[model samples]
Target chain A: MFPPRSQRILLAVLAASALLSAVSGRLNPYFLDVALGAGISVVLASSLNLINGFTGQFSLGHAGFMAVGAYASAMLTTTLAPRLGLSANLLQWVFFPLSLVAGGLLAALAGVAVGAPSLRLKGDYLAIVTLGFGEIIKVVLQNVDAVGASRGLTGIPSHTNFFWVFGSAAVTVYVVWALLNSTYGRGFLAVADDEVAAEAMGLNTTGYKITAFVVGAFFAGVAGGLYAHLKGYLNPGGFSFDKSIEIVVMVILGGMGRHSGVVVAALLLTVLTESLRQTGAFRMIVYSVLLIVLMLTRPQGLFVWPLWSKKEGRP
Target chain B: MNRSVSGPRSRRSFLTLAACSAVLAGCREKDGDTGAQAIRLGLFGALSGSEAGLGQYTDMGATLALEEVNAAGGVLGRRLEMVREDNRTMAGESATAVKKLLSRDQVVAVIGDGNSGRCLEAGPLCQAAGVPMVSPAATNPKVTEIGDCIFRVCFTDPFQGAVMARFARETLHLSKVGLLVDASAPYSLGLASVFRERFAAEGGTVVSEQRFSGGDKDFRAQLTALKSAGIEAVFAPSYYHSGGLILRQARDLGFDGPMLGSDGWEAPELLEVAGRTAEGSYFPVHFSPENTDPLVAGFLDRFRRRFGKPPTGVSALAFDTLQLIADALRRAGSAEPPAIRAALASTREFQGITGRISMDSGRNARKPAVIIGVRDGAFRFLRVVDPGDPGRASS
Candidate 1:
């Protein structure tokens, strides 16, 4: 958790982010477009960062949890909102949060289900399992009629705006960052530092690993809920393997264990992606060239070069 | 609930922030029109990516119509301007592109979306923004069902299937048929089901039915089964890529009946893959370049002169879509979004490059579908299937 003084500033930053977002969203949809996209990316990266960075679990199923959360929450809102007999405003302001939380909880259970088997496996093996899980989820979703099958589910209320998106982003960051300051977070760090040492120290490494995995999945689910409502449409293709890899890139390029690094990286990638579409035919060409140049210039990450690096032996 | 109350100070600020944002939203609820002189129309589609091979035709067609409309003294006494954006053939990108077009470009009408999924993503926003969007080639039934503001230049999916079944049963005199459906594709599956139902109702027997996923290139087994059944024709409701492979495979297996398909075979690569075997194949297209109609000929001439090649069916549909928008604008007599939508809805007997197009209340175009056959490495005109052709027998 942030110190008391730092917490106040963090709270202020959150407040200002919301205020700026609202103003931009209202003034013109273009700014809202950037903010909304960046905000979702922030949530997704921050959640995945909890697992892949702090816990050192190489989970590639971030987008799968996101899809599950998105489809579930979207299904609830689209089907129940009208039948709940609540006004549209009330449905969004009140019931939507309930659906988002429910979606997150379900995603957490899925994370547990996938984690229980593969957490004991080593790095690349875990990555393959998680990657496989992602593809399986996408394949399963494609065949499910309840979610509109391959055609995708439409008529999802556009309940997501800057406030909801940035609000969820703030909440995701706060919860994950706060966990890093908790004893459970220390267990996660111990496991990442050395699983053998963590086990010898009676830290229950597997339990700690599961906690991080569940927390990561929960936030990813929340991100999915925001995404579905924002896009007002959800296709299995939207949450493909490429999407899962995208979040992993943010976590890696942001730095392994730095919150601000992940935040900056997510915003950069999302805004860069949407803005670069203006390049027309060359957007894809520019995207790969930019990534290659960045990789060559700073292999550690875009922002992980100095600010958050550990300086040892300073005393 | 108590925990959510974080602290008195933070809670107060949160409330203040929400109130402020609400006020701001109210302030900008109704944006003031800048009242630009030019009537801005928007076009969005896959200008790049896998589908771009086909979608590029759509881009040219819309751009050509924009040029033609502006050259003929514009719409509503204003030079019609097109603000085109590339959707990149992705789902979320289409929604983003439409949002930008509606807000940033402030386009009153959008003509776009050669693909159905992309159109579905963009349709909701156009409906919400009170802007009209006409999809040039999206054939899914759910697209127009999104809202009244969303319309399409092409016929709906089921109608396309029925058109093919009629062309096969009545025109080609095929009594039995086999279906090689791609179960993974929504477009393929939808057309397959409709064709099956319509063909069965026509007293035509489906002696053989085989299934294949979209990416499956090998269909020797399915082709072998079709050979055994001795069906008169095979209806392959697949895109050009798979359609070409299926036809080539079928020919290799020595099943030489008339291979029927839908507009999914509009791509030039279909002929390239199947080669000489692609000739004598049939499919229903919205517009055929071989049409001797004056309007169709003029479009083909202009298209060939501009792009150095004749326009494909998608291109022709896109050109007609833009012209339809221009026609609606002329009839509405204003650049107002609502009036343009009304004009688009009440569109009747719109004689364009495609054909005479009328809109049902569902925003679907009621028009004749042209059945095209391949011969000598080019699409040749077969016959026009009228919209209300009777003798639709029950199964």
Candidate 2:
């Protein structure tokens, strides 16, 4: 059980994010870019942790939900926001945040569409279904001329600063933490532990799985919206199967079910990537080697054991 | 289950926060010192990803120009310093790279984003900062439309597509053509669409249009579809990797008329992979090393002497782009970005290795496209087709 201090934690996170965003203008732009990248990774990995780590569902289409959110928010902010008759200052606060929320809602809808049928299947079958869904989203985005087709959507006003990115990240962490600690959230653990037994106990395992998928996908969409504004452009290729694998890797490397461990892993991996920029052409080779060594050494997750007290009746 | 209250958990969280700040502090230490009097010029590209060749070639070309300019008393009495960043070929990475070049490195002008997708990501930032960005070979028309500060030395897709269509219709005398487009690439699709419309407008019929994704090795199926459609020539708008295989496969199918392609088909692999079957294939190229122009000869010699390898068309365009920047810098008489942009926009009849270049109203180079014919595993120059007179392609 979590302490009755969720409201205080939320306020602290918001204050810290706003303070960082205020002074971030004076930071080295390269460091700021890398930090923003790390914040986005934390959002993505934590949301994915909800499904794969806590709910025991192997959903591989996080990037698809992300692309849906990115494009939706990109279109809203770029095309629809200009027509809303709001002043520039009002548009920044109103249209931008609303568009991000709209993007998250649309991605949640996509999550329901994917989870309703696929939740019946388990393990590799669910993984395959989600993988196919991700590909389908990419190909559809590639062909839809309304969204610029293969040329990609550009001219998205850059609305994502440190406050927006880290603020969303903090909110994501709080929501996932708060939800998982609630009594109703115990069904997710039961389903993840033993699906048949959870159903035998009348726990409605499918409903729990669907809930995890919807919440995880909503955050992933917000992450995508932040990403589109960060880069000011969206190419379908950017949300390919490779991107999905990246988020999955972060989750697995972070000790899946643990939120704090996932955040550290996301930040470490992001910093590692930016540091390897000095290695020139061999950076990828070195990066893969480091990952292989990490996996070989810390199979249970990098920041798992000894960092937290061992739970009862668990390894 | 005894749930211990959080003592170590808070410590671990504090450690994570400390590690994050340490990383940020370490990044701050890397703020390098540039030469006091050097005019820094930046280039960002996919130097370490699948598209690494584009970046490497651009760097070599730009460095050669930098050497020559510095040797000739430099521009504005200051040596031109080349600062390059690897974008890793991703759009998001490219934005960060461009931002670093602008804010961290403080380069006066940015150059050499060979891929259009990456350039689009970098273009808006450069435009917003009032910094001139001269792309060497990103041929998408939308690149320059970002703003007046964005310029490209290479011809756009529409120009090359129109040139190939005219060549197929007038020179090759082909009325019915079949198209094999690479659907995965925007370049291929853009070129294919333009060629389709222009060929039709030229009174030539597009008999069949088939699609294949990039990295698909076999094209016999699409070639068969086109061959059976009773087409006189095959128009495969793709890069040299698949372009070569398409040519060889069409020949194997005994349907060799004259294969017409765009500038994407200019790599040496087109002749090597297609082998003897590559003969009679024509493609529009930015530069042909076989040209007898003194500018072309001088560029080839200098590039070979420095990089110790023959230059590709991409390198030639990159060489022209950097030289154009240096020319603009000298003409502007100041190293300021806005002045350089103004000077670049006013460029007219500046002879580059590729050809005489002039910046049009759109900040695109208004230059001729060179047509190259393949014969015996070598690229041969055919004619120069100017934009004004598409019909007058004189050798």
Candidate 3:
């Protein structure tokens, strides 16, 4: 067997190869687009996992962060694109990176504001507060006249591509992965294990929890920003509670806090949902049934086997 | 416990490796192009969920049009293949669907995004990819306003709103109107704005304006307020999902005022949901089912035979959009996006089931609007309002 470091290098090389193949232009751009969407979902699901999985705080307002990111990035790009007066190709190269970071920062700010108030509560109360916050964001976005209000913000120059989406996803995965391995990550796990013990250990449980929440929000915001550029339109309805739930589902089905699990879930759910289009009204019924059954049988998720499991006899 | 921690980390690394391999496989599959014979045209709309009926109708409409075109020896002697995707009434999914159609399926064109918001989301992706897309029923002007590549067959909210507003004033003699709009819906909010502007400009008073979200079933509070406003007419610009519920609740609450709405309320399910309450409710539709024009008659027969129901305005619009696209492709003699867009723009006097369509500078169809009312459990045609007048009263 390869050493751990060699395995990591091999994985990175494989990922790069896969991404290059996606960008090779000979393949249909549509699949590349789907891959891009999967990438964005990775960012959203993994970020959400930080709060809902590791920190043991449930949030259904990830879409709100997405909205903040989308609008902020769109406005920035719109302003900078004209002033910079770069060619479309060059402009895309410069603006996409900047917009993504801007989106993440804005989302992190929103996360702090929402997390500070709601993290004080527990379980269902946090859920309700977060849900309400999501709705409030939608309403606020709808009423903002400068961003086109209910009519929606259109004419956004499309700068998002396969490279940008996948690159962001890689960054999101790396950051979250690094965070999960650090001391702060242990604080998060401690809180998830038992809040009282974590607090007793002088972990500043509130601060660590809020940090996880903010980090998750930041990535969701980045995803949203990428989404806006990809679609070239932004509307309040695009970032509702349903959207938040979708990200949550990805994390849950992928085995929360498990990086590979989330990635698998995002791709599977997207394709499964799309493929079931022919089922008409029964599609959601089937989806609900599948989810329920999965929950009942394997609550630990399809990917319960961790990456480094030492169970010698297991598959 | 320490083992558990290490276990997850190592497992995560392994899983990442596996994910990377899977993605690599996906990329390889993308590179190996199968030289597909036919020109793939994508059909995307709400195919499931709450708006499945709309999606079904749109698919039927597009399919029929494709059938007719194929019967006429196909476009440019190459058979047109439709790659369909269901948006499921969600904007995010709609964007994803469009991307799949454009990038994966390699469709030259796309059609059928019934919801305004979905169309709005899909429009940019099409523009970016230089894919020509013509939505059959998405009437929000913002869809086309995204870029030159995005176009629609139906008239916009402004035109439909003006038509309904004029119908309320001239036909129903409703001078004082109450507005009950879905605040959460872009279509409703947009239609309401135009309706208010046109209604007030045409010597009509909007006595009160009330709001409800898209999924709100109980509209009694808003209806009660509108009722107390002493309005002769109520303009509820919303989809059939909430529109039917509102109309039923309003009738049950004994507020029997004439309800006026734009094209959003032109679904047959409105009658099913609102039942007897749907009677006397007027809406501006792009096409009336009562039209005896030979082309419309043929369309109705085919549609009824296929779907086992009479075609609604949405289906007709979808049908017209497909035909329009086929017509443009024929005229352009190529499926290239830019050529198709130019052909679409220059299209004039093109015989469509709705009317003789001529593309304006904005690429919107210049067609007459029809006012239809529900009577005897069916849509009864009132009259066709001519273009260029905005349905306003002449001095």
Candidate 4:
């Protein structure tokens, strides 16, 4: 069971988010857009946290899985939803979530296909493989005429709103938190700490690693679906290796396996990036400097070690 | 197991979440006051990417136009202010730039995004916000198709491609050609496909076709392949950076045949990169500096006096685009976006430095493309290819 106070906090956060979503139409469109972006970042960073943080797998191709999900779901919404002959509300409310689930399933399958063999390699080798895989997906998407190739897939339905984005973020956070806390999830920690010892102790290390990849990739796919719908456009360049690096930075900056820390980092990074846009041409320079300062000052992740030192029994 | 739920750490995490929300809310202050005296316009482009050279050209052109307008008594008796954002030629950045321009800067009009893909990315956002966007040189046919509020000052790829194809087949009298297409750029892809189709229709044979990604410096492999095919000309539809490299590489590979290009090759950096090897290569542009028209001579004189160099085709397009917007504001007699949109929609026979520009039904500029050939490290006027004029070129 989860902690009672944490549950209260989660409930309170969810209620407030829902209330805000209800009145989102009245809010400034710019802030609403930023909030939706932050929500997607939360989903991506949290799911990435499950693999790279707790499971100790370095995946530089999370964006590849996201691309698979984005393209798969986008194909359905743009190509299939119209043929269903459903009404507007029916298509959005009923068919949209189905498309997202289908997209996530495809991404999970891709994860298994990629992770089954590649997960055997650890650390830097695994990172290189994932990075290559991300590029492969981008190049393949670029040549696929059905998805518009390098010209990019446009006219995607704009069904992603505050409710869908935040609701998915909440679900992603809960799944990642609950799955890691349960007894069955201890195998993941063992694998992360020392794969050889866990294997000697009769733990299915490969299974845990594959499971982490599958689940992580699944949520990443869902996040991609949300992203495709939010922007109403999808391009291979949107899910390039640079995109995967962005998610990794979020997970690392949030302190690996700490769920709350990752969440906070995602929110702050998205907000900081948007706010820095007002600085004109030096926006990116200012953002990089702030990130460097944060990393140097708090190398253990922005908000993790200080608060959880006592709970995790660290010095 | 630790049983405490309300530990100080958990409370702190909760406070962090609250603080995050507070920051988001605090940044939600009302939009900038529009009651100011200046009529603001938004300009955005790839200011720091592989296409940064083109960005510089556009920025310089817009600045010159801004200064000229202000010097000639401001628009509607109010100073015209331009707010610029750099998209960095990256995906999704254009949408964010457009959002900031529309919501925060509250500009009456937006003019920018010379590349088609970036223009498409920002088109829908401007349409939804009821703001008009004028692109200087995004040549894709699909750009203005996004919505009513989206417009461009350049000819579409379909027209540009056909013009190039006809020029290569008829003017050059070349029966065989090689194709070098930029696979990554929508602008290049669109132009390449149309050229392929149109060239075949013109009874010209494409002996070989090769592809290279945008920003690729090593074009020897592709260029060597095209040279071996023994084609008379190579049509490399790419931006200046890659186009210039292709031209130099083709010459180095001993392909003396002319390398035909689209408007994407109009930047001065092409001459800088290709040097003397760029001679005999030809490309279609919005306007040629070699025009004998007094209006063009006057514009070039002022541009040279200001920038100490000849303005590229994009800079000219940018200058005309901003002038078009200012003209709309003057005609509308108001700084409101809808009124400006209407004035822009009614643009007719507007005399520009490029040529006479009229907004067609599709919101595209109905104008001719000027073919400029590089001779002795200078761009010289070749011929004017009117729309649907076939091969009749009046030199």
Tell me how far the alpha carbon of residue B28 in candidate 3 is from the true structure, in angstroms, after superposition: 5.0
Instruction: Report RMSD for candidate 4.
Output: 5.1
Provide all candidates' interface root-mean-square deviations.
Answer: 9.1, 3.5, 3.5, 3.9
User: Of models 3 and 4, which has the larger TM-score?
Assistant: 4
Sorted by lDDT (best first), the order is 2, 4, 1, 3
Better candidate by DockQ, 2 or 4: 2
lDDT, candidate 4, B171-214, per-residue tens: 89998888898887767777777777778888998899999887
Question: Against the true structure, what is model 2's DockQ?
Answer: 0.31
TM-score of 4: 0.84
Candidate 3: count of backbone clashes, pairs at least 3 residues apart or interchain:
11
Which digits, one per residue and each the tens of the lDDT, describe model 1 over residues B242-271? 999988998888878899988889888999
Best by TM-score: 2
- Model 1 CA lDDT for position B220: 93
Segments in model 1 whose C-alpha atoms lie over 4 Å from true places: A1-25, A200-202, A275-315, B1-35, B173-259, B264-281, B288-301, B308-311, B374-381, B389-395
lDDT of 3 at A290: 82
TM-score of each: 0.82, 0.85, 0.79, 0.84
Which CAPRI quality tier does the interface of model 4 achieve?
A: acceptable
DockQ order, best first, reads 3, 2, 4, 1
Q: Which candidate tops lDDT? A: 2
How much is the TM-score of the A chain of model 3? 0.90
Candidate 2: misplaced stretches above 4 Å?
A1-3, A26-28, A305-307, A310-315, B1-23, B71-73, B161-260, B264-279, B301-305, B376-379, B389-395
Candidate 2 per-residue lDDT, tens place, B1-395, comes to 11211224473355347446745754755666767799999999877767889888988888888899999999888999987888777658888888878987788899958888788888998999999999999887788889989999988876777788878877778899999999888778878887887788889999999999988999999999999999999999889999999999999999979998887788778888999999999999888888888889989998899989999888999899999999999999999999999999999999999888988888888888899998778889998766453222110
